[model samples]
Target chain A: MTDNKYAFFIGCLIPYRELAYEISARRIAKKLGIKLITMPDANCCGLPIDPVNHEMSIALAARNLCIAEDMGLNIITLCNGCFATLTKTNKQLKKDRELRQRVNKYLADISLEFKGSIEVKHFIEILAEDVGIEKLSELVTKPFNDLKVAEHYGCHFLRPHKYLETENPENPTVLTKLIELTGATVVDYLDESECCGGTVLGIDPNIPLSLARDKLKNIKEAGAEAIITICPNCHMIYDLNQPRIEKTFSETYGLPVLHYPQLLGLAMGITPEELALDELRVKADKVLSRLVEEIKVKH
Target chain B: MSNEVKTYRKPLRIDPEFKNLVLKMPGGETLKICFQCGTCTSSCPIAQIIDTYRPNQLMRLAQFGLKDKVLSSKTIWLCAACATCVDRCPQGVEMASVLRVLKNLAVKEGCVPRVFKDFGSAILKTGFVYNIPKTRTKKREDAGLPPLSKTKIEDIKKLAEKTGFIDTIKGEESDDRQ
Candidate 1:
């Protein structure tokens, strides 16, 4: 029985750009009794080039699916982009025979075949569904004590509802409910479903900077101490670009952006070192220090 | 007062087959069904922030068979692919997917944005957009995680050639070096 085992597919970003996200996710999954088996030879999830070449995008995603099928385990993706492409291609291939035949023919060159048996899920899905919020709350050693944080629902996690039915597109409650389990309050902000604008960062970076600045403006106005993100790309845009956004917009909003995994790890009583929280571009010191003070009084 | 109807005209070249051409492309079949309601534009996150990116106008251009104008505009490249507009469309018009089709068409027509071409070349060469630096590998090792794996370059190259990606990026590689 493939009960809790998952073929972990960490796309390009987390391994290089966002190590803290990967570290915390692994540490938390271990504590939750879930097994994540890394597929070493997995390539990019093909989202970065989806617009340029649809065929290449689908083929790359199919190759990863085939790799997971060989292990006889479902996929658990860390990045939202990976989840979108994998789920989209998996659904497309299962429903469209011609597409399946074409992708399989391409895979034949690499000695792989996509059978479409394996399922692809975001790490949040596994947490919300498999772990169950109540059990997650029970495992929390240090609650956020009403730390107000905003949730940035990265685009691919909830949209294209025909394929991704995990949450409502307009107003998602899964990420909010999961955050509540950490004892943190999800602050409401404008355009919560707003794109992080990372997609156009390369074409015209100033646009994303302004967009991120706008989102941060709303986040700060809502009195959020930090922002929580599901996708590394969003995290990079928000966390890594906070200073740049400040420089560009001539404002100061030092809102710490944490990956949901990092926040969950903190509540699970995992130390900062284990989660690699120190490596975050925007420091979570204010939030972490508050927790430290609360823990001191509790003891 | 002169009671005359002054008809002003500017030359417009419309390709009646352009709409059909777009319909034949993957994700472009629904190009004709868009009612030009501006819902896609209003719902688009990028469109709201960036004044130049108008999804509704782009759709109109596509439907009008303004091939050159529709494909060359920076607006098509500005869509973040958030799917908000697609989900919000009352007519079930997959605006994001249609935009993808337009972007691919733009590339074949040799009007792709410089950034996209650079990203494509990087993918063609390494199978990953960005190379994982040695410092990053050390950090991953410190965190008790396995180092990032190297992709099978030969297989990726084979797939690219079959998908015409190799040809798309043929001359662009040398141009990037300078």
Candidate 2:
């Protein structure tokens, strides 16, 4: 277990924008005794450009993969888009020699090569698989025993079975299992497999915002104190867009969103400041205070 | 009741050549396999929210070679690429991938929406779709986090050049040019 190391692929979103996810992820990984060395010069996961140029997307992802292979460690990504891109790239390179040859030629010029040796895992996968649920619960000094949290397993975490095969695409219980380990009740909502609709925000924002609102309405109605997600894009859509959704629909649903790592960090007795919980757009103050009071009573 | 004769007209123009063009893309090879099952359309969240975004109709338009209509329609850009349709499609049609191919063609023909162009140009320049602003850096620093590492711009630039990223942004057909 001490030798468990991964080249942390801190994709463009987490490093530059989402500091709370970054901080909490780091804190949790440290607490769990996992070594996450930053991959040097890790570029974008090449998702934004995927729709524009498929070859370029593969090539860019190949470049990142080559960086990790050079270091002889598997890659772990925090963002779902990055997880999909890197995992897809690895799978594609392993199966298609011609595509690998073409991408390798581009990398050859830059003194890099895609040897297809290393693997890619999302942080959620690492937590769930490497850290078993029972062991994870043992590390929880403060649990959300009374909290009702809804798990938003974003689309990429399970779909496109050709590339990723972590859980059942239709009825994924892996996220639920992880949430339950925190001693919180996992609430089910309608359209659990529904896309967060953030991907088309550029095309027509109304639809994505509306989709977010509907999801929030369902989660609130299900009596969830907070929403938890693993992907940054999903977090942005649910947590960052809640106020906009409320304003658009003229409703007051103050549902706080938590990254799975943030929740895990809280359960590990990490201070809210260390987890950067205060940075969330939809405040988690009430939920955090409730958990804190529960811990105080136990003490 | 009086009976009035209704005239149904066929599609005025069909560009089978455009369909052939899309078929050459990596994931576009399965375009003709779609049987108009409507599974994709029904499964698409965006299609449910927006009346105009019907994946089944888009497939039919492509099959009918309605190149101009399909390429220029807001429907192609509206796909979230969530792969729900791809997973649900009975024929294994990669609907989202086909949409991407259409989007590429749209960009080549100068039919790209402003949002896509802005997003594309940002990646072309910064190797990232979004760049961190100064205020964001200050906030992170004040919170005691180290400054975000600067990307190796040249390495990314080289990869971008090889991929014809610049040409894609310029709306040129990079595949044939290379």
Number of the top candidate by DockQ? Answer: 1
Model 1 ranges with Cα > 4 A deviation: A292-299, B1-10, B171-178
- Say what the RMSD of model 1 is: 4.1
DockQ for all models, in order?
0.55, 0.47
Candidate 1 chain B worst ten-residue window by lDDT: B1-10
Best by TM-score: 1
lDDT of 2 by residue, A141-256 (tens): 78775889888888887878767877778888888988887778898888878889877777678878988888888888988999999999889888878888888889999999
DockQ of 2: 0.47
Across all candidates, what is each one's fraction of true contacts kept?
Answer: 0.69, 0.63
- Score chain A of each prediction against the true chain A by TM-score and list the results: 0.96, 0.95
Q: What is the Cα-based lDDT of residue B127 in candidate 2?
A: 66
TM-score for predicted model 2 compared with the true structure: 0.92
Check candidate 1 and list the clashing pairs: none
Error of 2 at B30 (Å): 1.6
User: Tens-digit lDDT track for model 1 on A79-173?
Assistant: 98899989999999999898899888888899988887989999999999998888888877777775899999898998888777777888789
